[model samples]
Target: MPRPLWTGAISFGLVTIPVKVVSATEDHSIHFRQVHLEDMGRVRTKKVCELDGQALSQDEIGKGYELSKEQTVPITDEELDQMPLPTAKAIEIVSFVDAESIDPIRISDSYYLATDGQVAAKPYTLLRKALERSDKVAIAKFAWHNRERLGLLRVREGAIVLHSMRWPDEIRSPESLAPRKVELDEGEIERAVQLTDTMALDTITGFRDAYRDALEKLLTAKSEGKELPEPAEGGEREQGQVLDLMAALNASVAAAKESRGEAGGGEATVHEMRPSKKATAQKTASRKKSTAQKTTAKKTAEVKKTTAGRKRTARKQSAS
Candidate 1:
């Protein structure tokens, strides 16, 4: 059993469910260590105070807030505890809303809420089932990492899950990021939607981290004293966006159909919209040229062998 990150009670009106918060996810990303290149020794870091030019211990560190150009205020943990806040030690349920009403973009970190002990299981299961049956999520507030956080509480896999969320003001407008807009055609949109449907899946079951897998294989080969495979050639170059949206859309739809093995009727359409056949012919010609070169080399080797045999015979006859 993994240790709980936080032990707290969920407050809802007159109900309190004692629960432990556990992280719901793990980082699978690869990590590396900084080292001295000459000796392969791990590099080390230290926390040095800028004023005294000395390494400082964790206990000597203090939190300060800058008020003005040269004015600052130091805050302590005791002082922070004295401040009045409702979400300091409890998950306070503020409101219950339809889950679909909340945008998923606002959600951030995830945590699982498990009952602390056998005695707390009843209320925990009750709340979980209630949220599941009602088809709603509870908006709650809690204090964590010295700040108040808004969270969404919902049920998942017969357990309660909490998702910390960003405030409305934190989300930026899309228009602010992309000021320029291009007009879209209805026919192009229809074809694009059709292409999307052709490539859609109920769930992403085939996805894998190819880079990680290749790195693992490389490390295994190094340990086994084996040679590494040659590096692959560069991938195909990306095409620029087509100004003729209809042609692009038709090509995309045809390509998607072809990928799904439904291109029997789309072959002509795909060729009409794309110059793919010409590219294929060029590739075929290059392969044939390579084969012809190999055949010519083989014939030259045979002719040299025949000429050497005749010269040997002529030398023997002259000597006799």
Candidate 2:
């Protein structure tokens, strides 16, 4: 387990839960380094001045905020650090609110909390079980990552988990993402909802990261000198039909009911696709096969080129 990055007491009224925050998630995606094409050497970037085209030293660099399209307001780190609030300390809970009241978008990252040296187990249990029973999450204010954050605190399992939520203005509105809707008949709606329900799994595990896995497979094939087949072309999308407000809403409610039915289904899939060792092995094998096929194709191309060159040489010699 990783050590907590920050430690503090979470207080609401007279209750204080002495807790340490540890990151709840980690990303393990492979990263790539840029290389120079000509020499096939690793590429390095140099910092240079935009105005003068001269390389800048680390000591000479300073932070600046653009006041306008052309004007910038430069500030020193020393001056910014002298603010009344310590960016490193204190997660102050300004007010109490029902956890359900907060928007889901506000919840950004979550961290696991561990008890401080001597916090009472009874109070911790009291808070956790009470929140669980009441179905209320605690909303608090804190400083993190150089800004004041509004966070949701909930007792998950035995300990309290803190989720740093983004401010409302920071997230784009749903209006910005309103382009993917389509009008549907009652039958199509039912079928699509049923398919969605069938596709849904209890938890989000056992599934491969389809896009990421495909990308890795492609890269592996390239590394092995394989030729990839072109993807089948997609048919042009037809224009979407407009939805009738009341009818669409009724259909959506029905779809939601269908989703609930899937979630509450009694029967478990006999295959138990996720959490099975066999499924994972099959996926890995598929990736290996695709990469190997690519390598074989490249070798065939090379051999064809070699054979052609030998034939040309024989023809030239005969003519001479």
Candidate 3:
């Protein structure tokens, strides 16, 4: 089992469930240290006082808030600990809300809340069951790292998980980042929807960090004094080429269907653009001209046939 990062109690109404907080995720990324190029000696950073130019130990460092260019106020851990924070020792559930109502962007780090002792088993199970049945998540407030933070509590895989959240004021408005008004036809919207549907999956468990895998391979080759592996071929798009929106969507849909081993003959076909007003008017004028020519040819043929019949009847009457 992993070591717990914190020990606290879940403050649910009048019930207190003692719990231990452990990280829900782990990093598998490879890290490197800075080193001198000539001797490969590790290069390390030293914390030094700016005024005296003296290197300091970790214990000598303390938190401080800057007031002005020449002024700063030093703060001690003891003073911060003694502050009036009700949620210091507990994960206080302020309210419960629908899980779907929470904005995903505001949530950050996640930790698993496990029962601290046998006495906590009953209340912990009760809270988990209540959350599961109601299908709601708990909004909470807790103090960590010398500051109070907004949190979200929800049950995941039969265990309570606390997700740290950004405060409402901490989230920046996205209005300035939005693009200016642009018009799109229904065909484009429908094609985009079709592409999304084609790319839909029930879960995203199959993906892996390709860059990390390549880095590991490169490191292994270098350490073993072997030839490095070359990158795979034919996986690049044409850079700087302007693409039609509808055409791109159609290609994406086709590619997605092909990846899933589905037939892309008919379903992924591109939409034909509608005729423009000028083209429609030209077609109308051409049809009218052709109709008038056909009418003139029919009238001339009838007149010729009528004159031939009149001459033949007159000759027959004169011969009689």
- Give the number of the best model, judged by lDDT: 3
lDDT per residue for candidate 2 within 117-194, as digits (tens), equals 665556667777877887888777877655688888787667788889888889887887687886657776676566
lDDT of 3 at 204: 98
Total backbone collisions, model 1: 0
Per-residue accuracy of model 3 over 1-320 as CA lDDT, tens digit each: 69999999999999999999999999999999999999999999999999999999999999899999899999999999889999988999999999899999999999999999999999999999999999999999999989999999998899999999999898999999999998998999999999889989999999999989999999999999999999877454334433477776877788788888999734433323334456779999999999999999999999999999999999999999
List ranges where model 1 is wrong by over 4 Å.
179-181, 222-225, 234-236, 263-320
lDDT of each: 0.85, 0.72, 0.90
Could you tell me the C-alpha RMSD of candidate 2 in Å?
A: 17.0
In candidate 2, list every pair of residues with a backbone clash: 106-165, 226-294
Residue pairs of candidate 1 with colliding backbone atoms:
none
Point out the higher-scoring one by TM-score: 1 or 3: 3
Better of 2 and 3 by lDDT: 3
TM-score of each: 0.78, 0.58, 0.81
